[model samples]
Target: MTISWLYIGIFLVVSLGLPAVAIILAGILAPKKPSPEKSIIYECGVDTHGETWVQFKAQYYLIGLVFLIFDIETVFLYPWAVAFDRLGLFAVLEGLLFIGILTGGLVYAWKKGAFEWA
Candidate 1:
């Protein structure tokens, strides 16, 4: 048990130390050149126009989050589906329950006008 703990302690030290060392070395060795153009916000090789801090509609984020949630649901379900033949009836019922919960959430969001483009 102590040997196993020793291994874990070493692994933890290396994992945490490597990134810290890399970050410190990068800060020490990287170029320190500073200029007005570099300080200015640059993106897509185009000069920024108008207000960059414009507020977006909350509906856009809702749509994106809904899409992401469903996308992740597919990721989790795909493996379960691939192994469906070996799974028992209880597994099937549990999977259906998970899907039902997500579906109910979708219906709630729909009723709350989260899907509205306006």
Candidate 2:
């Protein structure tokens, strides 16, 4: 019992102490330079031309959410398709229902002008 506790104590000490040690060592050994160019925001090596926060239409977020919902629906369908033989008709019906709900959501989003892209 005490041996198990010793292992746990060692584990706790190592996990907690390792991060502090790394930070202390880095603080001591790391470079102490702050150049103006080094502090600039990076964007794939291309120079930033304008303001960072631009006005975006709410439709963009709605379309993104719709894509995410459909993407998740596809992910669920793939696993269900793999085990489809074992699950038989019940799984098929469930999968169909999931697709139906996602399709309905897509149609609703279309009606709400989410796909306008303007």
**Prediction 2 global C-alpha lDDT:** 0.87
* 7-70 per-residue lDDT for model 2 (tens digits): 9999999999999999999999999898999988888788889887989888768877888988
Cα shift from native, residue 16, model 1 (Å): 32
Clashing pairs in 1: none
Deviating ranges (above 4 Å) for candidate 1: 1-49
Candidate lDDT values, in order: 0.92, 0.87
Best by lDDT: 1
Q: CA lDDT of 55 in candidate 2?
A: 92
- lDDT per residue as tens, model 1, 1-118: 9999999999999999999999999999998999998888876778888987899899888999889988898689999999999999999999999999899989998999998887
User: Which window of ten consecutive residues has the lowest lDDT sum in model 2?
Assistant: 56-65
How far out, in Å, is residue 53 in model 1?
A: 4.9
